[model samples]
Target: MPVAECGRPASPLIVVLSGPGGAGKGTIARMLVEADGSLRLSRSWTSRERRADDPDDAYVFVDRAAFEVRRADDGFIEWNLFLGCYYGTPVPDPADDRVLLLEIDVAGGRQVLDRHADALCVFVDAPSDAELYRRLVGRGDGADRAA
Candidate 1:
């Protein structure tokens, strides 16, 4: 069943930010929230290999069992297993009356659109493949030529 927006299912501003792996979704989300106080970035929970310097404040890192428990309890707006890891958005407090920005992948974006047809989906794109590769490699992950 598609998850409906709390109360106002007709027109809720569910902003979806999606792009290639190296595209700057996190940066954009931060900027949007900083610029507009009414924008809320939904913090995601993950059960994945964490990066060494990733600010622990970024995501709620958990083991697979814990994540599954949350999912079973319907604590997530959307959850999925990706690339051998789990990732999900926690249910936002709808009473906040803010634009909820969900930084998700193409598949997750589709799920949000399916649930809320009125959602504003924004596809963030890189200037070029070279630029994306450069950014990815610069981030300390050895970029592949095919990337």
Candidate 2:
């Protein structure tokens, strides 16, 4: 992948947002994506147990067998076992000019950076850990606070 003048990938720019569980990475990613039309959020596939209040749009919830099938077929660009469940970013299709935002863990972020050297890696950090925890707890609705 070729790096653009702005330090992002040329055609299919992979933007990775990652941080601690309580960090504001997801919030920032959502804000940037909602404010911009060019950015597209890659929905993740997960084999984890879903919460009662889990957002329907958060992930494409699948059973263990289905997740294993995708994993065996290498359908994911990057996948990791976190909190006893599997999470992965689907392989992205070629885009003429579009920024793909991936909200994943640090491990997955490193994987994207390694696979696509030109990809831009953004680490969203809160002012303090306490503040992050507060924000996580204070999220009104549709926030994945359980990790």
Candidate 3:
């Protein structure tokens, strides 16, 4: 029997793993997907170049032009700009059986929650402000904002 949500059979759950930059959402999401056969991580699209330490598959790296084209074409379910870079999640295939796992910026995560009321969200918080700042600087991703 299918699980019922809001009086209807629940679709595969969208699990949003959100956090501030360098808070390790990607790491946690990867671990979850590796451990759970039922989860499939959705790689978000971004105009920003991948960091040296970032895994090659962290995001669907694209130029600004391509990102804008997709955004204008209504390809993303939710999108946001952070530190002057565009990041967005694509529309998922309805036939997919594995639950979607997303590691995204906080703003975009909020948008997802608003759009999908049934989404299950988990915020990966930094242990401390100082530690978060260190991680940001170490990643060379402009930690000045966090400072």
Candidate 4:
């Protein structure tokens, strides 16, 4: 039975990492998850075309219809469309006391904060505009617009 149904106390940790498009939030998240055994990364679903250098398992690439269906089924805890592409986080069911890390954008981060007051919210970014631009360019994600 589920912990809630069993009346067992299991307070899982949810970490929501958010920042601007060219920010280093993803990099930070990756590093944390890699270094911590108790932290699990919640891979989000996206309808956007994958980036050239994106890893094979960076995201669950789905079409619009599939994404909408998941939304209708309440699969995603938070979701939004940015830059004409849909991005959503699937409801994570981590083991008891484990930390679930979510690397998301500003809008989706707000949605998560509204639902989860206990979540640890972390905003990550480069040291300066030049650094941010340099990171984005290096990652093959050009600036979405003029800074």
Best by TM-score: 3
lDDT by residue for model 2 (53-131), tens: 5688889999888998999999998998876789999998785366888998899989888888877788877798667
Q: Give the Cα error of residue 28 in candidate 3, in Å.
A: 0.9
lDDT of 4 by residue, 3-67 (tens): 12333335776788998876877778888877777777889999999988889988999999999
For all predicted structures, in order, the TM-scores are: 0.82, 0.80, 0.88, 0.85
Which regions of candidate 2 deviate over 4 angstroms?
Answer: 1-10, 134-147
Model 1 clash pairs?
none
Distance (Å) between predicted and true CA of 129, model 4?
1.6
lDDT of each: 0.79, 0.79, 0.83, 0.81
Best by lDDT, which number? 3
lDDT for model 1: 0.79
Clash count, candidate 2: 0
Badly placed stretches (over 4 Å) of model 4 are 1-9, 94-97, 143-147
- TM-score attained by model 4: 0.85
Candidate 3 lDDT over 1-147, as tens digits, reads 222222433587888988888798978987878777777999899998788877888889999999999999989978988879899999888999668888887887899999898887888988998898888888786756667
In order of lDDT, best first, we have 3, 4, 1, 2
Give per-model CA RMSD.
5.4, 4.4, 3.3, 5.1
Scanning candidate 3 in windows of ten residues, the lowest lDDT window is 1-10
lDDT of 1 at 122: 88
